[model samples]
Target: MLGTVEERVQSCPECGEEIRTDHRFVPWCAACDWNVDPGEPEEPGGRLEALRRRLAREHGERLLAEVTTDEALRPRRDAASVLALALASAVHGFTVALFVGGVLLVVLGWGGALPVLGALCLPIAWLLRPRFSRLPEDEQVLYRSDAPELFALIDEIGGAVGTTGVHAVAVNGETNASVSTYGLRRRRLLTIGLGLWEMLTAGQRIALLGHELGHYAGGDTRHGLVIGNALGSLRTWLYLLSRIESPTAPEAVLNAFYLLPRGAVLGAAMALDHLTLRATQRGEYLADSFAARCGSTEAAVGLMDALMVSGSADVTLLRESNALRGHRGAAGEAESGLWDRLAAHTESIPASEYERQRRRGALRGHSVDSTHPPTHLRRSRLLAVAALPAAVTVDAARGSAVRTELSGARKLVARRILNGG
Candidate 1:
């Protein structure tokens, strides 16, 4: 998604309808009532107290692992959903063409050939769209922009967590993040929202990114993307069928004959999507665990607060601003084309308005088929994961220890060079 040029001043997060700024970065929005920056550390309370507060703040809407990553969840992407979409699309197209041809055939008294031709065309088109439409790695990278700082951090975290290199990272406008894998080699993509950056404290943002990368560490991205695309095809087919009744007319009759079967194809596709979704949700917890293991549980807490603050703040502003204009927010805006628009709405609402719809309860949690899980669930899961035991903490003591290790290593190297040993 393209970023809008800073224009048309609106209410500030701290003071509404008074001042506007081009900068998207913010630690807190006082006027809008949100919190993105990491909160001040709580006083030394018991471990349980910290955990309790985190849970109370989150309200139990967390993502949990529902399958084994190495087995059940890994194979989903390349299996059938992609093919199903292809098949459904071909059928839909052929059915339409046949309907058109049938009309001509009826006029010409050539009824026998019309249905046969339609059947042949329908499945072929359905199969081809997905085959041709597979996203290249570079295109996936373009979905969100990345910065060098973030990349360095990912590299550090990957080493700490003992994973292969971080795959892909991008920025969207929403207060969200996700991980996905599409095939056998097990490469993964990690995405974060621009709003997430605007809302989170530096430490918290690191924790959040680490959590997404954790999905890769746990092995999800290689299969998830492919499955998602396949299920998407199913959704498209079923959705079209659900909208029609008859094929008597060019649009109607073709829809009637092709859509119903395609919808069935989607049902299976949706099931696959669900499996991936469930596994991904679980993968979130593993990433969280990794982040906590890296000595940043407080960062996890800060991430949650940032999500709540950013989400509430962004929505309050966007909704009110959109309300003044008397139109649905960007989500309601028409797409560039049918396929593009359908894919946009299907994939996820644009980042520009995700928090707004999410806040208003307009978006369903499970019913959604996007790379990221819902914001609320993400926040809660982070909090819950923060409660897990950790191997280290991001404290002054830890910093000193690392410094000591480096100093000792430097001294030993210097002596070796000096003594010519």
Candidate 2:
């Protein structure tokens, strides 16, 4: 809370329109939306992106139509999932073959003629091995000892979602949240962006948790190490090969060596993504269903609403960052309540603004990105059916304790954001 902010009436400085706001919040004319940006309009990524958007829109519309008649409860699979599984397995098998081939070449070449070839295989095998994530250096890591109440709430939500809770949590000053595995042990980590987390209500927070964890419950093969690492390795190969531009005669000769391999890798990467794209989309929808189950339909819808406004929140951050430049002056302070202002920015948006965003989303084929289904379709699916009560709840006491636990980290994040880090 921004300490019980009181409404003050005023005229918009730009449009001279009537406006209202509190001390911590910026006043903007409803007509002009001077500072309130739900987000900037999305730029088309390219031709492939346009095609993906069209496909996603069509698929999402069909799925929403399906959800209207079908009860939205447990997730279901389809033929696309089967195809995706087959393709994922094939990629993993190929990686395993690379290891076996490399090992055998080295072993056989120990006393054989192809010693040079065998040595080459070893590097290739190691290069393409399945890899997982590493803990982020930029984000603050939280342990159970560091924030017991927060982890307890996470545990409760995980249990509600039917997966073990995260082994650790990391907080950063971005507008995103994600679940990823780190280290050789592959222990689960939940990364929460305080920028987004700070703006959400308790219910919306639950929905966020459920949606990320739901990726687990839905068995998101796209995210699993099998397909994830395989596609990742292929991408790495593509990146490396792409850098070999033929600027000189010698470079051209060398580039020719990798040209065929790059094309092959690109084709392989596209196939993997193409085969799995639908399944990935399905996993997202399933995750949202889990979100609805754990956070209740109303809150899940609010979560979608939050995502829709994320770009604006990003703009708010920049706006605040620039606003602080004169005062902070090359040295940012941790004491400035940048987050309180961010939270207030969200608070200042009314229901009518949200409604306008929803309408715009339909015309825009609103999506979080190219990977997921359109937000308008996702929201419509939720609204098409009646929602059960939230399975997990964080009452006021729990919420307060969690906030208290995060107080230090929140201050650190605020300092980082204001400092232009």
lDDT of 2 by residue, 224-332 (tens): 7777887777766776677454369888887888888877776676666666777777777778888888999999998898877776688878766666676866334
Off by over 4 Å in 2: 1-54, 103-113, 243-261, 329-336, 366-368
Checking candidate 2 for backbone clashes, the offending pairs are none
Q: Write the per-residue lDDT of candidate 1 for residues 1-421, one digit (tens) a residue.
A: 3234353345555555343333343333335534322334434243323433343233324323232222222223443435544544554454456456545555555566765665554554454233322223322242213344345556777776767545555334345776654344544556554435444444565576666666666766324434444444555545555545453567776766675576566556544543344444555556666665554767775565455445454443343334334332432222112123222222332343334333422234432323444555554544543254433334555444433433332333222222222
lDDT of each: 0.45, 0.76
4 Cα displacement, candidate 2 (Å): 17
How far residue 313's Cα lies from its native spot in candidate 1, in Å, is 3.8
lDDT of 2: 0.76
In TM-score terms, candidate 1 sits at: 0.46
lDDT value, candidate 1, whole model: 0.45
